[model samples]
Target: MKRPEDIAEQFQEAWNSHEMTALAALFCADASFVNRFGHYVRGVQEIVALHAPIHETIYSDSTMQNEVISTIALGDDAAVLHCWSRLNIGKAHPAGPHSVDTVILAVLRLLPNGWRIQALENVTLTNPRTGQPVLRT
Candidate 1:
C-alpha cells in the first residue's frame, strides 16, 4: 500500500525535475487531470499532449510543493486524497518568485501499473499577475 506521503513525494519530484513524461506515466490510462486553472484533461495521451507545450514554456524555474491533508481509502481498489499545493513560480519578475496556493483533490486507483492517478481536481489560488482569473495552460 502506497502512503499519501510517498505519493506526495513523487508528485514533488516530478514537478521539481520537470519530468512530464514520468509524471504522465504515473497516471492510469484513463486518468483525468484538472489543473489549477480548471482545465480538465482525460487519459494519458491528452495529459501528455497538453503538458508538452506548457512544460516547455512555463515553470522555467518553478517548484511545486504539496502537503497532504487527508486520505480516504475507498474499498480495496481506490483512494481519495486531499492536499494543498504551493507553487513558487521562479524569478522572472522583479520581486522574484511569486507564490500561488491551491487545493487539490485526487482519486487514485490500484492498477497493474501501481498506484496510478485516476482523477484529479483543483481549487486554485489567486493569480497575482493581471489581477484577472488565471487559467492553466
Candidate 2:
C-alpha cells in the first residue's frame, strides 16, 4: 500500500469483489477481527473462514463504500484508523435488499512488506432508543 490510509480502499475493493484471499492478504497472520454481528475471531485464516461463506451466501451481491474517518499514528510502526462504511445488502441476504451503515476501527502495523491490519472491530450504526439498525444518522 502506498499509504496507511489506503487500507480502507483495499478492504472495500476486496469485499466488493468477494475475494477472501485478497482480504486475507490485507491482514497479519495473527490478526484479529470482530464483525458487525459481534462474531470475533483471531488469525487471518479464521477471519477468512468466517468471511468466505458469507460472501458466497448473504453478501454475494453486496457492495460496500468505505470512507476513512480518521487515521491516528500510534507510533512509527503502528496506527489506528476508523472508517465509516455503507453496505448495500444483497437480495440473497436474510435482510433482503437494504443498506446499512457501520463504523470500523482497525489497528494497523507497518510490516516488512508494507502495512497490514493487526486488529479490527466493526459495529453497525443503530438507533439507541429503538435498538434498530440505522441507515444513516
Candidate 3:
C-alpha cells in the first residue's frame, strides 16, 4: 500500500484508540513531533511520554481525522507528506469542545519493516475569533 494510505490508516486507528504504544509505533526511532502550540517532542520514547498524559486528560475524549493533501516520493526510500487533521479536543478546556484544525508535514523513511514517520511538524490554525471580543473586566 502507499505510504500515505498506510499512515492514514495507522493514524486513525491509533489516535482513535488513544493508545500510547500504538501511536508511538508509527514513528521512527528518532522521530520528532511538534504539536499545534509548537510544543516540540522528539524521539519515539519522548513522543510516547508526551502523548500519555494528554491522552489521559485533555485529549482523553478526543477524536482525530487526517486529510492527506499531497505526497512527494523521494526516489524509492523516502517521501514527504502534507496533510491536515481535525482534532475534536472539545473536552480539553473548560471553554467547551473546540475542534482544532492542524496542518502537518511529515517526512517518512521506507525501512525494512515499512514506512515510518521520520519527523512530523504540526501547526494549529487559530479560529478567526481567537483572542477576539476583548472580555469585560
Candidate 4:
C-alpha cells in the first residue's frame, strides 16, 4: 500500500489536472464526497458525474496545494485525513490569489485493488457574504 502522503498527492494531482476519470479511479465503488458547498455525492459514479464538470469548467487551469495536517488509522484498512488546502485558480502568480480556504476530512478504505477514498467531507473556511476567511464548524 502507498503511504497516505503519496495517496493524497495523487488525488491532488488528479484534481489539479481536472481529470474526472482519473479522480474517480481513486475512489471506492460506493464512495461519497461532500463538498464545501454542502453538496454530497454518493458513489464513484455520482462523484465522477457530479464532481468533474465543475472542475473541468471552472478550475481547469487551477492549481491546488494541500497540507496534510494529520492522519489516523482507524484499522488496518481504513483511515481518516484532516487537511488544509488553498486553490490558486489562475496562473497570474501569487497576486492573482483568489484563495479558497478549505478543510477536508476524508475516510479512506483499502480495497482489494488499492487505497481508495471511501468518503470525504469538504467545508469552506470563509464567510459567504463578505468572502472573508472564517473558521468552519
Q: Per-residue error at 119 for model 3, in Å? A: 0.2
List TM-scores for all candidates, in order: 0.82, 0.97, 0.86, 0.84
Give the per-residue lDDT of model 3 (tens digit) for 1-137: 34654786687679889988889889999999887678898899998998888888888888988888889998798899887777776566566786767777888999888889988888776546783322111
**lDDT of each structure?**
0.76, 0.94, 0.80, 0.78
Model 3, residue 134: displacement in angstroms?
18
List residue ranges in candidate 2 displaced over 4 A: none
Using lDDT as the measure, name the better of candidate 1 and candidate 2: 2
Question: Candidate 2's residue-wise lDDT over 8-41, tens digit each?
Answer: 9999999999999899999999999999999999
Give per-residue CA lDDT, model 1, range 9-128, as digits (tens): 677777778777778867788989988777888999998887666556667578888889898999777889888888888775345767777888889888765677888787876667
Against the correct fold, how does model 2 do in TM-score? 0.97
TM-score, model 1 to reference: 0.82
Higher lDDT: candidate 3 or 4? 3
Residue pairs clashing, model 1: none
Candidate 4: worst-modelled 10 consecutive residues by lDDT: 90-99
Candidate 4 is scored at a TM of 0.84
Query: What's the candidate order when arranged by decreasing TM-score?
Result: 2, 3, 4, 1
Please name the candidate that would achieve the greatest TM-score relative to the true structure.
2
Model 3, runs deviating above 4 Å: 127-137
Clashing pairs in 3: 90-97
